[model samples]
Target: MNNINSGWRSGILEKIQGRLMKVYLLARRFRKHIKDLKNIPRTPRCGLSKQETIINKH
Candidate 1:
């Protein structure tokens, strides 16, 4: 009876550890996705960007 109880407890512990590992993996993947998204190229509109010249005449 004692051995059966111990086995059941160990199984529960293993399940908890597995769930924690999965959560960590998901967080890592989400972080990588955000970093990769930051590398994507963007299009400038209105014929201007921060590097372009702007001319104003009065």
Candidate 2:
């Protein structure tokens, strides 16, 4: 019984660890993407309407 319990617990722990790793990887990728976006230069729009430019800002 004890061996079965330990096995079950380990299985659950592995599943939790796998899920945490996936979340961590996704967060890292998202952060990198945000950093890349911030590094990009914003060019001035020549002919866009004020409302359009404002909308594009966000």
Candidate 3:
């Protein structure tokens, strides 16, 4: 029957919408985490620079 077909279509659409919402939520969470990390200041690492040579002078 046409009504049965419509019901099936509606069900499929609902499942697709649910999946899309879950993906959107995950993307938003990832974006927020990335933004938080970006806001943190990173200190530059000096690998055996002049400061260490002077300090280690014998």
Residue 5 lDDT (model 1):
100
Q: Model 2: per-residue lDDT, tens digit, 1-58?
A: 9999999999999999999999999899777756655544463444235534544564
The window of 10 residues in a row where model 3 has the poorest summed lDDT is: 43-52
Q: Give TM-scores for every candidate, taking all chains together and pairing residue i with residue i.
A: 0.58, 0.66, 0.66
| lDDT for model 1 | 0.65
Query: In model 2, what lDDT does residue 5 have?
Result: 100
Instruction: Please report the candidate that would top lDDT against the real structure.
Output: 2
lDDT of each: 0.65, 0.71, 0.69
